[model samples]
Target: HNKRVAIDLTLPEHLPVLYADFKQLRQVLYNCFANSEEVMSDGGKITICAQELAGERLELRLTDTGPGVADDDLKLIFKKFFTTKKKGIGLGLPVCRQIVRAHNGSITLKNNPGGGASIILRLPLRPLITIGHGRRTNRAA
Candidate 1:
């Protein structure tokens, strides 16, 4: 498919540093960008935006100019082995969710009002803290 697609990736001058595995986080981003490209097979623009949310969280949202996801399928997108694409194994989103969870982050999806879908991922800026045995443990730094 020789479809012409335009990508607009925007990052601010400053961002909150998040603690996450480089490879896993890269994979998640690749999956999202690739999915947007696939959905806009004919040709469309994919806009990726990043911002710093409250509580020092990082928010990244990818919105594509393509057909949006069905309401019924929205909830299942993150489920293991679920997908709407004919050739997709459906493991991409699931793995993304798993990796995000491991980093104490969250991934969500929604349909854009005009058209296409939006994938939102939030990552914590600081390492997670847990208390066990009367001791505070930092998961990652």
Candidate 2:
């Protein structure tokens, strides 16, 4: 992309996070951003957002101003070895789905209202909790 292409990111405050391989998560997010950039071709805007949800959950969203995906292909977008790209291995989305699922999270893709694609991820804010003495405690929600 070019400098004209805007990428916005937002994250929620006071959110708890589950134990996960951050490296893998970063790779997945990178792949998704790269895909969006490629689809834009000339250049477009990309936005990334995150929020804390009820029940110790987190939500992450990435949206792009590129051509949106076909309605029929939305379901198969995460299937392994399935791709519409001219020179793609077809494993990016699938791998991302697998990684998210492994962390008890979910990944979804949809078309933006204005025209573009959006990928949403839902994750847990705290995978495990330890209870015992000598540990700092916080009020329960």
Candidate 3:
């Protein structure tokens, strides 16, 4: 955890609540942040922006000020075991994609026009919630 890696959050005053698996979502975020931190070893900025989309979905975009992914590798960024890091086994982005899909959401990565990379995650605002055996579960609405 580098204290120098600053996170700037630009969010709506009132964001819609999401019915999601907290642990899984947290892990996804951690993976994204870790990747950014690793690439910006000297420290950089991570900007996070969130907004509601047409009352049907929530969009969260995370952008980092590190060198963006190579154009040739963009297609394989979320593939399992495909990594640019010397020590990475390449499961991070794949796992993140799986988690996002399971939540009935979509995740995408793109290089910024000026520099760095941006990851966009879009999820439904209202997920179908069901209770069974004293446990709650969410599904695509």
Candidate 4:
């Protein structure tokens, strides 16, 4: 890829650990980064900031230097099969929301004052140890 993009990760020195599937969480991050990169076609800086919320939550913010999405499209961005890109089949943000929810988290998008789009993902500080539905046992002994 010859595209020039800058990514800045602004995270706490000692980040708290969460129990989650490495692959799934990776996909979530990947989608966000890819989305930001796609919007900034001509090379722009993407800032990733993370903070610990007051209510035992983790907030991850991905900000890009591309023109922000229209206000009308903000609400529809996370909707399945919705996209502003020419080749985008849409599913990216929708899947991101779903994945965040699975981790008992949330995702939101808004426009930055200067320009560009800011997407925030808030996740629980204490996540479930396992990622599957608990095993059901027949206790009728």
* C-alpha lDDT (0 to 100) for residue 28 of candidate 3: 89
Q: Can you give the lDDT of residue 137 in candidate 2?
A: 31
Q: Which ten residues in a row have the lowest lDDT in candidate 4?
A: 132-141
Best by TM-score: 3
lDDT score at residue 68, model 4, on the 0-100 scale: 89
Q: Compute each candidate's TM-score over C-alphas.
A: 0.87, 0.84, 0.89, 0.86
What local distance difference test score does each model get? 0.87, 0.83, 0.89, 0.83
Kindly report which residue stretches of model 4 are placed more than 4 angstroms away from their true locations once superposed.
Answer: 1-3, 129-141
Across 1-114, the per-residue lDDT of candidate 1 in tens digits comes to 325988888999987677768999999999988888887878999889999987568999999998989999998999988989999899999999999888778999999899
lDDT of 3 at 14: 97
Q: Candidate 3 on 49-130: residue-level lDDT in tens?
A: 9999987878989999999999989999999999999999999999999999888799999999989999998988777565
**TM-score of model 3 relative to the true fold?**
0.89
Alpha carbon lDDT at 69, candidate 4: 90
TM-score computed on alpha carbons, candidate 4? 0.86
In terms of lDDT, model 4 sits at 0.83
lDDT of 1 at 79: 91
Relative to the unseen true structure, what is the C-alpha lDDT of residue 112 in candidate 3, on a scale of 0 to 100?
99
